[model samples]
Target chain A: MPTRARRWHISWLLLAAATIPLLAVVSLFVGVSEVSLAALLSGQDGGRAAEVLMISRLPRTLALILAGSGMAVCGTIMQMLARNRFVEPSTAGTVESASLGILAVMLLAPGLPMFGKMLVAALFALAGTSLFLAILRRIPLRSVLLVPLVGIMLGGVISAITTFFAYRTDMLQSISAWTTGDFSGVLRGRYELLWIAAGLTLLAYFAAARFTVAGMGEAFATNVGLNYRRIVALGLLIVSMVTAAVVVTVGMVPFIGLIVPNVVSLALGDNLSKSLPWVAILGAGFVLVCDIAGRLILYPYEVPIGTVIGIVGSAFFLFLILRPNARVA
Target chain B: MIELKSVSKQYGDTLVVDGVDLTLPKGGVTSIIGPNGAGKSTLLSMMSRLLPMSTGWIGIDGLDVTKTRGDVLARRLSILRQDNHMTARLTVRDLVAFGRYPYTKDRPTGEDKVHVDRALGFLDLQPLADRFLDELSGGQRQRAFVAMVLCQDTDYALFDEPLNNLDMRHAAGMMRLLRRAADHFNKTIVLVLHDINFASCYSDHIVAMKAGKVAFQGAPDAVMQASVLTEIFNTDMAIHEIAGRKIAVFY
Candidate 1:
């Protein structure tokens, strides 16, 4: 029995695959350093350029790929699970919940290791996402516009709580900086948790078809013998853990998840198993482009990637909202 | 046989499906017909395990529906609800392929492909198999969904309002296909149909419900009588025999 041919479009796959390394190479060169290729190849200038490249530039680039692709995958999974195109960690309260968890851990266990902090954040994220889904189940959800609005409001409530606590504890500055989503602080050891997020993205790839069926709604999924609730739980777990990893490691990069998946689906259709690779590649490529833009925009003074994405992402999001045909599928 | 023992469903104080016992024959076209709010769809939902019975138990071929593993039951029975609005953009072929998920679990074997192709052909959907579902007309979309259910290849198949958006031509075609499925494959086909004429013409047995209880059940000829139809529907219904078939006229 020959299996149905996988719907992998070799042209798009190759193009996206090729774009990532090109962006990575360009990203490796964009920074405060003035190290030419000839200088590095000569081995003449005492390895200062090599040290800076290895320590800061390489780690930063890796962090961008991991966090970007991870968040995009998180967005894709959340969107599918919610049956709304606008869902992502930032909108869905997962990021705020992670921030709240980080703040709590800072106050309660100030000396907790990074891994422990990520675990706490991930747990809180899972709880927050569950609450969101519970709220979603109660509503009629007839309008497509209402879904993201509800999510944004939920996020606002959680963010307000986090801000209140930060204010009372006199740690608003630290908390705000942590949540700003800058890649400048992504050192070798600090960005390792995003690796776990990368692994979760792979798990999402393996479970893509189940998630697609689950996205068709509970009855459709259950009738086909897929465990709808279990699949939804798995999706939420992946979404929360990935969001937590990105939030802890590099802060919240808002719209990468929402936009990348939307763009990929627009071009390639919604067969998740076939489209996930493109989603990952485009996600990484998009972040690299944005990070480089932020770095070069201010030259010696680096602008945060979060601020850059926030501006561009919000504009694109508004376009989606106001677009004449953005009706719910 | 699909057997229900004192099955009932309630929402708070309102009992949508009253405690009723029923035993459906193993293989035939059985159409459940009722007016608005007759609990016909609700009863079908419970029998197929799509909705939990407030009390009592349902057994399909001696296996308790509530206790059977979902995959096992999926191979035995499949049900489709009225509304199937999907956010994902899926082609008809992709949608039908999902019917085999119970057996293949995402990895489609050549056998699964055969089932999908056969189901598509059964519904005459081969020409539009690659077209996106949203792009199809309402009647075409209904056929696509029926194709998916048929591709599930279960022993018993149930549908709620399968003719809701279909035109007369498509509706009649759908009924003929369902009748053929029962006759050729020896499958138990159950449907909640609003059109009494369609039921009278295509169904081997008819079950009529009123106010949450079964009012009549028998061969189509017996239930299609003017007295039974008028009483169950609370209106004037005239039954005429033509070419040895009972036709109901309620206009």
Candidate 2:
């Protein structure tokens, strides 16, 4: 046999490539009603089982892939922008700001279009990120470890403002549905908007290296002729916009960004130009696997993908923090 | 040519860099040497736009360094500071590849690869190109970072304490590299150096800074005199000519 055809970083690629399909297949088949390969291939909407598969499984699978991959890449981009591996759209306040924007639109103009809500959310998210970044520049902390803590606090303040308004309006339950971001609710037309996250992922891939270079401090990047601020602005725009789109379409799924990118960087190293494609793949795969497990782990009444991922993802992040070599970047 | 007009920087009540006007000729190496707390680094930082000036202006090659698009100014100028800690984990090779980002927009072509290779080789980092930065020795990483800056291939390169952590052999090697870069490439090299001997021996022009101002600006022969050295450093110093080079000893 040919010596196991090995390429540098190929094993991760192969593992990721192989897992994508298996998880995708399992995602389609392992939902509330167990639709086997035969049943899916038969193409008949027979009984309540077929409706469950058609309405639930198919859209859930697409949503899992989209939300998972979208959050992951968004996290990756935010981490690069803030130069801290711990930060993502969720932690950096983009998601919360977006949610607030959506809520405000929902309350202020109860019949606003989804795209309009997302646009408003995207603008607020971008503004929030810029606000946090601006405040961050004020504090002279050379250690980037402290920066994320500040962002989290900044996000907390914004979230408190959001929660206060959410309570006053008594739309908590309505907003909470969009907040938890489970794929179980995603179906045909409802979830199609998440494709925007997919498009934003492509934009991120195109700008990956520029973002990474900008990560290496302003002077160094500017010295190389990169418009450090402009590249950073574009990067932040992509991150906030993608984040807003994800939150608007699906809801808040935390740490997919933070965990996936860091893991890819650790395994793949920091050539983001090379790491981005893999980040996207692994991001989508990790989320899909988690969502599928969430569906199958409890059977009939599926556990929320975000909850399952939050529990597991936080553990990975904790491990990252405790890891001796972990520098938070 | 580089020019600074009435440049000043203040942090609260303390002025780090006082109002200063100066002109620097193009080409060759120029060293900015000053006593501790004299704002040599701050002055250099202001010149390169690394630290924005509080009041005044800087122009490089006829374009305002402050007003020009960062990438446009970047193609013409570059600066490397003392500390080069990075959040991104990168191999020596990957780190050098980033130097082309301003021009190539992160999509490095074959020509970019050649430039990366040349920078690595120039810094004697060919063997360690594949090695991770964290895996390398401190001095080695310092050299790797320097190689990344040099790989930028800009005409004007500014370095703040390039020899900070280098061993004797590497320190000599770095000075030689900077000189070769200036001479061979027709590049303008600006550096903030602590070692007066290195500046005296290797620099074409010298800017001795004191109390946030340019105390003196002249050729090494003029600036390295016993009186100038004593006045600049505020210590008694003796100057000796060895092999037609000025070497100052202060005890």
Candidate 3:
């Protein structure tokens, strides 16, 4: 590694940190009801300003960044563990399976707490991932890429099931709207659940070295004296928990995890501990930038951050698929 | 010492390796040579506990390979199979550094780095330490993988066809590396080789296996006779001397 590039890399992290206050300020200032610089400085003469800043705007914006960063990091770890750039929580069907659990619970108990639905979804997602992995272990697939295909097909099945249940309940519109990820609802009590995702991301950072070793190969990991099964299981739990928490709070933001990690590793190698913080920061910054773009594009009215991220994320995903030889270091 | 007793492996109705019993002493190089479909690789897999044996016990230094904690055995034994394809793009140093994982997890101590440096230097990988495995020639990649296994610094090193893709000179160099690993490190090496001549020259003990059974096992001198080689290989063979070591010749 070049010394300058390494130093610049650390500096880039500082640069990302520097963007946080700006994102928070932008998030605080822009919304359907805006409080200008004058009002924010005055410490809120009107209750409207306080409600929007404390109860709605700040929480929603913080939720967007938190879940956004968490899901991206989760996606990064899953891709490494699965050893395929194409494998993400979305593509591996983890998100869809989690959606299935949430949908099932919503239909069964109309009065269930959001956290309860999230836990159920997390369980289902974990089960789906285990099912996918079991299929991977049994199939005589010559390539690791074949393993995630099973996840795609399985994800489709869960998505279908979720849609079917939603349609039957006459709540398909509401369900899909929530599931599609709208930061427009980034308000107080509801969005604070995203803090759970932030916690999971930190836990993932702490355990990153284990995840990187597990990524090499089962034989190599076992030879290194790691409890391969347990490490793998823990990785799956993190992926599922982070995915479920984010999905429950902010719905799904595709591709942040899938994209950021690969971009980081192009310079950082496959060491997860070295690359994870960058993945988290880059993810939050990327989402914040997109959210800012959404705010300014139409001025008073706004574009969905999810929609903006979707367009960019989809384009990047296509680039990954079309590149015959992926350059994920 | 490593012991395999009544070890058999079966896939459905197919008995791949059946009722093999062997005691391997803790020293030098032992080559297991056999025909194709003779269960050489599968047997190696069983001994390393990579593949679950159908019926048997594998005890390494008196600890059972199956029942023992994986990390404990990992420190004692290392195996390199043919065709080590990986998707991770890694430098030669990164790959060799994995050998220390059984010791340091991912955080390498200074001592671990020293082991990595020694392994890289041992395989002459210093010049190519920064090159990616995919960017290297097949023989070079093979050497890189060998360096990783050797860097593992275990008492028992097992290789399945260490010479599979090597050209003539590289193949001979690989044999020498194994020999040096055995002698200098005081490690026991068990290999599955296709070339009998290389085995005759480099191995302290020769193990001839056929149809999942041990056809012959003894010192290289005892196994190098024309009649013994012919019966074991099921082909006509001749022995010639290249500096006093018996070299098998058949053509």
Candidate 4:
């Protein structure tokens, strides 16, 4: 039986592994400016196709893969730490607090570089996630639904404050643009920060077993000689840093984190060490496909990746909630 | 030996375990039997270093529990609580393999696999080793948890109400398993038990607590008396010897 399970996981991993490159190729070719395979291979367009591939298409594709996998892994860690399936960066106010930090930097340090802005946003994300965890600890009635509901409420409150400030400063339009998560403007310089998020994702993979044990409540981890508090703190830092990097690079890509991990866990179990690779691959594929659809849906124009995933991810989230056999805690 | 010196646990103004000073000798099954709110579980938690003592100190062997590093102590001692709520969906093998974390840090070797298999065989969990924990019956799940604890291979094992959700037969089986662990493996086993009869039957030493203090501590024959049992539980109880084992009957 264990061997059968192992074979099943390997096949799924193989399928998932094959999917990302295919989607990346598709994403590279699907865009407003036509950069065909023939054109790139034959050098038929005087290196313009090559330039576009390097400057725009390749970076955009890399950003999608990096941000997608990063966010999905972030969600996995957050769910483990929170010990609830429904919690994610978008629901937990981490993204919103990151936006608030960006807003603060825009208003206070207008000349700050993009890296500086990302640093501040990551700091705020860390603080926001910690606050959410602190609140969860105080909440005596931590029903499965109530945890995410509390996170959503916290997000709403933070976004509302952000909106109020943006409205006063006449920066509402820019803030909306930043929060909506469009990858249309991703180029060589803009999307590189997501590599840091990817690095953090690798770190998460290294620490996956600890997170799995930590997910089994504090007493269980302590019995195994894990410093429970330290593991949780490390999980939060990874989650927040990933969220901030993705948000800073490409805005808020909602539900990829929430949906991808949930779907993977449904098929595979929640042993993060075994399942994280699947989560990362599936997440990248999901985002790449969504980005391609967003580009092709309106042809010359594009729907934002956030809007596309928001629609698809929310549908899955609702299904997860409404399903009879949903394993929630 | 497990030594407690003036150990107390206070929640606000209320003290749950009050200055519990006792010594449990190594290499035998010790049962802590008490009624509700007697702090048996609390004392067990403090002894295992799962809960910080309000005042005083606890030592296992020569190492102070509060001062010892977690991973170092983990190799020597292990504890299991009655209600272990986990969100991770794991196979029985996967769960039991976690017992090797103290040594392997999640990277299991050949020797660790041997230990895991032995534990599964000991608990008769080989058939269900591949099954997910949520797919198991309550008793099977309980056995799986016990297998994980056994796989830890610690010198001292502590359990808070190990038989909470077991049927009578399964509860007796669990008691026998603990007894065998103490007798064969030479492990120090301590348990918090509400069943006085089980305590009387299986334990080498019995300690009865009442209202945050130890009311009696001795062999089963000394602590299982009708007078001492009635005083500890505050109920009318009669002792009857069945097959040379003391049994308490309270109606």
For lDDT, candidate 3 versus 4, the one ahead is 4
Runs with alpha carbons beyond 4 Å of true place in candidate 4: A1-8, A327-329
- Which segments of candidate 2 are over 4 A away from where they belong? A1-15, A40-51, B242-244
Expressed as tens digits, the lDDT of each residue in B45-132 for candidate 1 is 8887778899989999999988898888999899999888888877899889999988988788889888999999988899998787
List TM-score per model, in order: 0.97, 0.93, 0.94, 0.98
- Cα displacement (angstroms), candidate 1, residue A71, comes to 1.0
Candidate 4 or 3, higher DockQ = 4
> lDDT tens digits, residues B1-251, model 3?
98999998898998888799999899999999878877889999888878789999999899988888888888999999876766665678888988887777767788987888899887789999888776788889989998998888999999999997888988888899889888887999999998888889999998888888888889999999999888877899999888988988888
Per-chain TM-score (chain B), model 4: 0.98
Worst 10 residues of 3 chain B by lDDT: B82-91
Candidate 2, pairs of clashing residues: A75-A257, A225-B71
Q: Which ten residues in a row have the lowest lDDT in candidate 1 chain B?
A: B130-139
* Evaluation by TM-score, superior candidate among 2 and 4: 4
- Candidate 2 accuracy as TM-score: 0.93
> In model 4, what are the clashing residue pairs, if there are any?
none
Per-residue C-alpha lDDT of model 4 across residues A167-281, encoded as one tens digit per residue: 9999999888877898999999998989899999999999999999998888888888999999999998898888988888899999988999998887777889899998899
- For candidate 3, the per-residue lDDT at A19 reads 85
Cα-lDDT of candidate 4: 0.91
Per-residue lDDT of candidate 2, residues A189-296 (tens digit): 777777887888888888777777877777777677777788878887888778887788778888888888988888767677778878888888888877877777
Supply candidate 3's per-residue lDDT for B237: 94
- Alpha-carbon local distance difference test for all models: 0.89, 0.83, 0.82, 0.91
CAPRI level of candidate 2: medium
**What does the lDDT read for residue A244 in candidate 3?**
87
